[model samples]
Target: MDQFTLNLLVVGATFALYFGIAIWARAGTTSEFYTAGGGVHPVLNGMATGADWMSAASFISMAGIIAAGGYDTSAYLMGWTGGYVLLAMLLAPYLRKFGKFTVPEFIGDRFYSQSARLVAVICLIVASVTYVIGQMTGVGVAFSRFLEVKASTGLYIGAAVVFFYAVLGGMKGITYTQVAQYVVLIFAYTIPAVFISLQLTGNALPPLGLFSTHIESGMPLLAKLDQVVQELGFAKYTGHSDTTLNMFLFTMSLMIGTAGLPHVIVRFFTVPKVADARASAGWALVFIALLYTVAPAVGAMARLNLISNIYPNGTQSDPIAYEARPDWMRNWETTGLLKFEDKNGDGLIEFYNDKSKNEDFNAAAAAKGWAGNELTVNNDIMVLANPEIARLPGWVVALVAAGGLAAALSTAAGLLLAISSAISHDLIKGSLNPNISEKGELMAARVSMGVAIAVATYLGLNPPGFAAQTVALAFGLAAASIFPALMMGIFSKRINNVGAVAGMLSGLLVTVVYIFLHKGWFFIPDTNSYTDAAPLLLSIKSTSFGAVGALVNFAVAFAVSRATAAPPQAIQDLVEGIRIPRGAGKAQSH
Candidate 1:
């Protein structure tokens, strides 16, 4: 069968399975819609959480980031993984013990103020919306290539699919559907890595293969990658070229952001008890590690494969003629993500880092009649294109297509659910209409999700950055606005409602403004007053500004709390109660 037909068959089969699961597990009440009726097993919740956590950013863009940026992008892996640890240790159990339906609800009650909930809702919507833009971008990229459609059309299709499953099933349906998604995505991700690893290193395990010798080069795989990339004017594969402060801050942002994310936080609520929440977190970490450990291998191998393809005779020799390039390049070119221009009219594509600091390489390229770099490959395409680039079977490619969709759609559902819940459950029912019936609230939740999806789809078209970069920005925002609030609310009895509201607003505003100054107001192109290359702050990129914002939040909250009255005695008692084991129902502050 043709490639398109194979993709359609595999992708369509996955979609059918997802729809079937959603239908079977469709939620029937507010409880089911909100928290899967609180009955999901720990292992199952962990699996679903894995799928929810590994969005298109993790599945599609993370390896690409690693492949292209090499060691500089390790922050993403470290940050996201560490962020989950933070969530599990510092936040998950306490929040689960609180027995709230959403993060905003928890904040509202804990702070003993409706305004705190409203602030959290705003923070949740902003962060969740930004995060969904990344998922939508991943969806568009995957569908655009595999389904043979325009990126916008692919986005609409993705949004529609999410609408069906997420709106119909709610958390109950989404939970089970995400479990199935986890299976598909992990297999899809690791299978190709295993194939590529075996092809390159003669090792079955991708992680071990990364440290193994390259079959063709007789050098360690990473050493071979470093040699090839540096020879072609790229940085060493294992080099740490980024600023230490930026990497530290970026990782911190992602870590705190992961802890603060409402969608991820809500996963714990789906379990029956606080202990289940902790167990679920452990299982999620295990599942997450399976993919995380394999990623560096996949990235290094794919980078080597790409370089080898371009310089079949080695970097010192002439590159392959444009017309002689591999079929993988041709396939990706159709999506406009991989482009080759015959610079200098040589009919040969020279793919190298033109801005490399190597003077000898620059002189050689100039002597050899090379102009600027002739090939442009989007970093987001690397993982999805890895199988084809390594000449894996067509079935593997099709499986990858399904896996990418599953990653993007699964996370999209979770994010939209968070947004919808914040709106319908926190904003509407809690604040606007306390008398809203369960049915009405559920309907509001569905409608809110539909609107969130539409908004996300629109923003996806004009995303501020690539999938992973956009996600990092969302993490920064979340880290700045939400993490401090949750921590303060749980750990500090003195942090009153005024303090929480002030801290969240100040943190969110500062971070958003910093991002807007660099990334454009609301991410409109060319409207930014500054760029990440020359940041307004001292070497702090907007993506890494979350840590700074978070500090600001903490400082502001503490100052405000001390300047004002302490929390009510009952509130202090409630905070004390939450720290103890089995004090959930017994605490009666609010």
Candidate 2:
């Protein structure tokens, strides 16, 4: 069957399964909607948390970025994975012991200030909403390809499927849905890696395959990739050309950001006990490692495969003629992901890093009758195109399409849940209506879900490239604002409402402003006063500014606390209570 038909069947089947599960697990109470009634198994919650954590950024974007970025890209893997360790150790169990339905609730009560809760709600919304934009775009992009619909139309379809499960089930719905999604996404991700690894390196294990000799070249796979890419004027596949300082800061920001994100931290609240929260985190890491460790292999192998196809006789030989490129390239060309221009008019495509120009490179291009680079390949295409690039069957390609959708939709659901809970549970019920009925609160949650979806759809219509960057930015924002406040609330007895509020706002404002100055004012696409290329502060890129923001937050909060009255005795007692696992309650605290 044709690829499109196969994609439809595969994607459609997964959607049906998700809808079935959502219907079976429809939430019945506010508690169910909020924290799956706090009764999930550690292993089950671990799987669900894995799905919630690995969004479009992890599944679709990470490996592709790594493929293009090579060694410097390790920041994403190291930072993101390491953040969970911090979350599990420093935050998860304490928050679970606090017995709160939402992160803002913990902040509000521990600080003994409604205003502090409001600030947390704002922080959560900013981070979660921004994060959803990318997942929405991922959904739209995946649908546009598999369904052959306009990007916006495909987005609506995917959003509708997510709404069916997420709105109806809340935490209960999402918990089970994410478990199924984790299975689908991991299966889809690993199957192709296995096939490609065996095909390219004659090794069944992808991680081992990365170091194994290439089937065609006697050299190790990474060495072969380095040689071929450098021959084409690209950096070596395993070279660390980026400044070590920037890499360290970026990784640090990501790690801090991961531990601070509300959506991810909220998953720990679903388990029955503080101990379960800790165990679940360990399992989540194991599940995450399954894909994380395989990604470099996929990246290295896919890069090698593409170059080998374009230069069948080797980089020293004539390049592939444009008219004679493979059908997969032709297919991707229609999506604007693969572009070509006959710059040299030899009907051949030459792709290399123009930025890596040198005397030898110029001389080689002249001798080879090559003009400037004639191909522009988007990095995000590497993973999506891996199956086709390796000549895998149509079924595998369709499964990948499904997997990408699952990744995007699952994370989008988790983020939206965080956004809605902040609005309804924290903003409306906590502050606006102390006496609001449970049904009224649930309705508010659903309405908030609708609003978040609308905003995400609008952004996804022409999603910025940075939409793919929300994962890191969200983590940074969380690290800078939420994580510090929460940590101090549990670990320190003197941090009062004033200190907490000041710290959160200080961190949030600095991080957001730094991002805006470089990324453009509000990411409006062209209104920025500065750029990450030449940052205003310490030559640090805006993306890595989160760690700085976090440091500032800690300093400001301590200074403010020293100047202000200590937290009320009631609040101090509450913090002390949360630090230990005893006296934990069954029902969530308002």
Candidate 3:
């Protein structure tokens, strides 16, 4: 079968499987609607959380960023995974013990203020909505590249599939579907990586292969990659070039953001007990680490593979013939992720950093009779193209396509669930209409889910920013606003309702304005006047500014809380109860 047909068959079948599961496991009660009935095994919850957390960023774009940016991009790996440790030690168990339907619900009841809950709801919706746009975009990109459809068409189809399962299954359906997604995504991700590792280094384990000697060059793989990329005027593969302070802050932002993300936090609520919540986090990290450890290896090896394909012999030798280039190159070229031009009237492709204004690199390229580097490749294409580059079987390639869809769709469903619950349980049920019936609230959740999907689809159709960049905003908002409020609610009895609300508003406004100034309003173009170089304040890039915003939140909250009366004794008791694991049970509608 043609690649497109095969991809369609594989991806279509996987969607069918998820839809079937959703139909079979449709939620019936409020408990099922919110926490999947709290019957989920720890391991299964761990796997589901892994699938939920990975999203399009982990599955589709992370390796590509690592491949292009080299060691400087290690912030993504460290930040995203390190956040789980924060979640486990500081947040998960307590939240589970509190046993809430939504993060905003916890904030509202804990703070004893309707406005505080409303603010939390707004933040939750904004973060989840922004995050889901990236996922829908990822699904579009994968489908367009593999299934031979326009990105818009792919997005529509993807949204339809997710809506089918998410609206039908609620948390119950999503949890089981995510377990299946984890299986598909991990298998698809690892198989091609293993093949490529063995092909380049004769090492079966990709992570070890990254540091081991390359079979072709008899040098350490990373060392060889460094040499080749440097010769092409790019930074060394394993050396840092960005400012250390910025990297540190960026990593910190991602870590805090990860812990604060509502969709991820809600997963802990589904586990049967507070102890299981902690254990589930450990298991989730184990599952996440499986992909995390292999990612750098994939990034390094894929970069090397790309360079080898372009140079054929070595950077010192003549470029590869255009006609003899692999099918993967021609295929990706069609997607505009990879491009080549026959500069200097040569029939060969020269792939290098043509924009290097450095004198030494320019002199070298000039002496080599090269006009300029003529290939432009998007970093997001690296992981998706890995299987094809390694000449893996058609089935493996199809499976990878399905896996990418699974990763994107699973995360989208999770985010939608969070968004829906925040609207229904926290906003409508808590304040807007306390008399809403269980069936009425369920209908409201479904309506919100459908609307959330529509908004995400529209944003995906006209992406305001890159996948990772947009996702970073979601993290920044979460880190600056919701995380501090929740943490202080548990850790400090002095933090009053007014204090929490003020702090969150300040943090949210600062972070949002900073991101908007750099990324533009709603990520639309012609909106940003300053780049990261001329940022709003210090040497901070918007991506790293979340930490600063978070600090501002803490300071404001502390100042305001000190000026106000302490919370009621009952509220204090609730905080203390949340800290301990005893008597934790299925969270109910308040």
Candidate 4:
């Protein structure tokens, strides 16, 4: 079959499977819609959580970042995964015991403040919306590439599919569908990685193969990558090149952000018991680690593969002829992810750091009769193009297309649920219409879902940045605001409404202002007043500032709580109740 037909068949079949499951698991009540009726098996919930957590950024863009950034990219893997350890131990069990429909609901009831709930709602919406935009963009990219449609057209189709499944299945449908998505995406991701590892190092294991000796040159894989990159005037693959302080803060930010994200935290609420919540987190990590561990390998191998393809005879010779570039190169170039400029009227494509400040490398290139590197490829293309790069069969390439769509669409559905629940359940029903009927609430949820998807699709067309960086902002916002309030609600019954509100407002404002100063206000052009070259405080990049914001939140909450009257005795009892695993009442329906 042709590539397009195969891609359609695979992607369509997956969508049909999810749609069928949604039909079978149609949520009959608000409890089912919000928490999957709280009977999801721990292992199944873990798989769903893995699929939920590993969005387009994890499945599509993570390896590309590692490929381009090398050792510095370890922050993503470490920060993202390590945060789960914190969630499993410190937060997940208690939250699950609380047994609420939404994160804000827990904070509202525990803190005894409507305003506190509102603050949590705002924070949740911001983080979830920002994160969803990245998924929409990924869906658009995947669709356009594989389906031969424009990105906007792809987004509409993707949105339609998500609407059908998400509106029909709600949490129950999304949860089970995510399990299927996890299987498809993980298989698609690891298979190419294993093949590349075997071809490069004669080792079957991608992670170990990354450290093993390269079969071609008998040098350690990392060492070989470092040599080739340096020969092209790029930073060494295994060396630390970024500032230590920034790296530390960035990693911390991602960790806290991961722990705080509402979409991920809500997954724990779907399981049956507190222990299941904890165990599910561990299982989620195991599943997530499968991809995380192999990611570095894929990145390094793909980088080496591209370098090798460019310099068929090594860096000691002329570049590969432009017309002789691999099919993957030509295919990706059409997507604008890869580009080539035939500088100096040569028919060859040079791939190197032509703008390097290294005088020695510049002088050497000049002596070699080369003008500059003529190839430009976006790092995001590495994963999606891996199968094509290895000359794999069309089925493998088609499976990858389905996998990318699954990754993007599954996360998009999850975020849409979060957004819809926050609006209809938390904001509209909680505040504006406390007497809303169950039928009315369900309709509201569906309407909110439709609106959220529209907004996400609009923003995705005008993306502010790459998937990972955009996701970082969302994490930072969640870490700064919602996470602190939820933690304080469970751990400290002394925290009053005033303390919770003050802490969330302070953290949210500080983080948003700091990010605006660096990333532009609302991410519009010409709004940013400062660059990373001269940061506001301690040289912290906007992406790395979330941890500091979280710290600020904790400090402010404690200080305010000490000065104010403690929460009522009833609130203290509520806090204690959520801490244990037994006798929790049935979760409320609308």
The clash numbers for all candidates, in the given order, read: 0, 1, 0, 0
Q: List residue ranges in candidate 4 displaced over 4 A.
A: 367-373, 521-523, 526-534
> Per-model C-alpha lDDT, please?
0.90, 0.85, 0.86, 0.85
lDDT of 2 at 281: 93
Give residue 436's lDDT in candidate 1 (0 to 100).
Answer: 91
Model 4 lDDT tens row, 8-56:
8988898788888999999888878888988899999999999999999
For model 2 the TM-score comes to: 0.96
Measured against the true structure, the TM-scores of the candidates, in listed sequence, are: 0.97, 0.96, 0.95, 0.96
| N/CA/C clash count, model 1 | 0
Worst 10 residues of 1 by lDDT: 581-590
In Å, residue 28's CA in model 2 sits off its true spot by: 2.4
After superposition, candidate 1 runs with Cα above 4 Å error: 520-524, 527-531, 583-590
Q: What local lDDT does model 4 show for residue 132?
A: 94
- Residue lDDT tens for model 3, 1-590: 88878987888788878988999889998789889998899999999999999988898888888988888888999999999899888988888888888899889989999999999999888888988988998888787688565666778888888889999999999999999999999998998889999998899999998888999889988889989988888877788777888788888888898889999999988988888888899899999998999999999888888888778777555888888889988887666557788898878887877777568998888887888878777666788888887678888889888888898999999999999999999888888899999999999999999999999998887665556766876887888888899889888878989899999999988888887775545456542122343555655678888888899999999998889888899998888888887778887767
Question: What does the lDDT come to for candidate 3?
Answer: 0.86
* Model 3 pairs in collision: none
